[model samples]
Target: MTALSELNDDVVRSMSIGAVFSDFDGKINCLDFHRTADLLVTSSDDDSVRFYDIATARLVKTTYHKKHGADRICFTHHPSSIICSSKHNPDSNGEFLRYLSMYDNRCLRYFKGHKERVVSLCMSPVNDGFMSGSLDHTVRMWDLRVNACQGIMHLQGRPTVAYDQQGLVFAASMEGGVIKLFDSRSYDKGPFDTFLVGGDTAEICDIKFSNDGKSMLLTTTNNTVYLLDAYHGEKKCGFSMDTSPTATIEATFTPDGQYVLSGSGDGNLHAWNISDEPNKVGSWDSYIGVVSCLRWAPRRVMFAAAAASVLTFWIPNDAKSEPGAPNPEG
Candidate 1:
């Protein structure tokens, strides 16, 4: 059955390439391109971050955004605002607040109380609340609504978080090799419950909620992907790719939940079809350096991935193929 499907399906019919863009003197450590505004933000290992107009593919500005180095960045749902973060270091007392920026890093807001490097940051998919996870083994909620620390939810191990469409939280941790789920409303008390994935496979690297909040996708250092029930974090399905694993650093689910996309230390971008049972329909490869980040842009019909100093846009094969096959970034 697997062999027959492989012959019949155009999982990766072809790849549509966009204008490749790059900047900065060092590796592009993190990237987030805005969908509506057509703005692209990239942070580098050189303690600098740059903004670019994607439609025009022109540099807008450069700012001393990070003191040591930037690890991740994202544009807030707010039109002109962006949020940036770094690993918490004890030597830096006000590092967390220094990381948040507005208007080319001129104005800053501090998020206090996290004692270690911040590992993950995300905006709530439903509400105005934004979240940050730290190596300190805690995930915190910040209400931009009130501009205050709303609550702190402790985790068993350092974890990365993703907010579902309904605003529920899903945290992926290496300690238990599982994803934990929590209601943003009940976060003040503690984690409401957790869904555990067993066996000593490898450290969990990234996690994201499906568009509808009904499913989730997780990646690991072992070059593997797992899909789960988003509400409870239950492992519903999983698949492995042929690409050699680097530090399989990030994974994202397509908006429709039919595909899993990831970037790795091996400098490659991979797409896997999870629309079927017991087997992944197909996979694809691109990019020349370690792909450290991946983000979906539905309005543009493409997804973006960042390597050391480059950004590449990937679109599904423009030609229509069979059903139940990987179409595009979806």
Candidate 2:
């Protein structure tokens, strides 16, 4: 594993926009990169789901859901499959979580239960089972092979959920800056531990566990991002941005967990060096719109950011010159 102290601000500042995909008609909701490949999956408010070849920086597949547009999307354990929580139709009693076969754009399974929009969805790192948190004040677990929900937990307010890298623990952020951690093996009995961020009244927009499982990142609607110790949930530091009043901006850590990246309503991408004093190290003007979604590649130094209708791929300028470095350009 790469040490966080070894990363410098220059390398992060060297990141430049390498490619851009601008075909979506609405704002990009989320971006997910394959754990072992250069493939990328994205969901948009335009009612479309897209697959892209990151190396070639081209669209590989495109599918649409006209009725209820896709929101939170993630790639399953299978390379050719994905799951997304979408809006509920008129006749439906609740929202539907669709597991789609990417090869044919067919719905393989539908998990339903949330009475409102499902705002958070995260796939388990080691299993086919995944979990979701919704505006309906519920968190439900599902398996990709089955249509029935496995378990459900009700909360007081909106929730943002995430799984640790080891898949042994999952965390759900609820109202009042509280985070509930559950053991994946026995979640039905209730959370084994809970952590609260003091003095924060913002609604958490998203939560992410570092790849090393040592740290966690939380993005809130109040334009702030909080870093915490994954095990004890002690607040390490926090970063803030100028976010739009209605936008749910996201943030993520680099693959090595050295730095934090976030999008801003000011059309800039922000980065902070986590190993040093908590401070802004780099900022790139995307110049697209309010950056709505941000994600880092699972095994590379690259990352992707999306705004209103554009997706941009970023890479370090010296990546090509470094010996044995993976080429960003195909």
Best by lDDT: 2
TM-score per candidate? 0.80, 0.93
lDDT of 1 by residue, 1-330 (tens): 112123223533344444466555777777776646767777777767777665444567777644446666777776567667753343545356333454645545656777787777777766667888787887777866454678777776656777766675545464668665666777555556777777745656677777666777777667667787766666877656434534345677665666666665555566666666534444455545656677765444456777667667654454224243222332
Q: Give the TM-score of candidate 1.
A: 0.80
RMSD of each: 6.2, 2.9
What Cα-based lDDT does every candidate model obtain? 0.62, 0.83
Q: After superposition, how far is residue 284 of candidate 1 from its true place, in Å?
A: 3.4
What stretches of model 2 exceed 4 Å from their correct place?
1-7, 88-90, 319-330
Residues 1-330 of candidate 2 have per-residue lDDT tens digits of: 122344568878888776778878988888898887778999988889999887666788999998878888999987779998885472365756888899988988778777788889999999888999888898999888887889999898889899999999999989999999999999988899999988989888799999899999998888788999998999999877896966767898987787899888777888898875677898888767777788988866677888878888877776556554433442
Residue 327 miss distance in model 1 (angstroms): 22
TM-score of 2: 0.93
The list of candidate 1 runs beyond 4 A from truth reads: 1-12, 56-58, 66-68, 87-94, 98-104, 145-148, 169-174, 241-246, 264-266, 278-281, 316-330
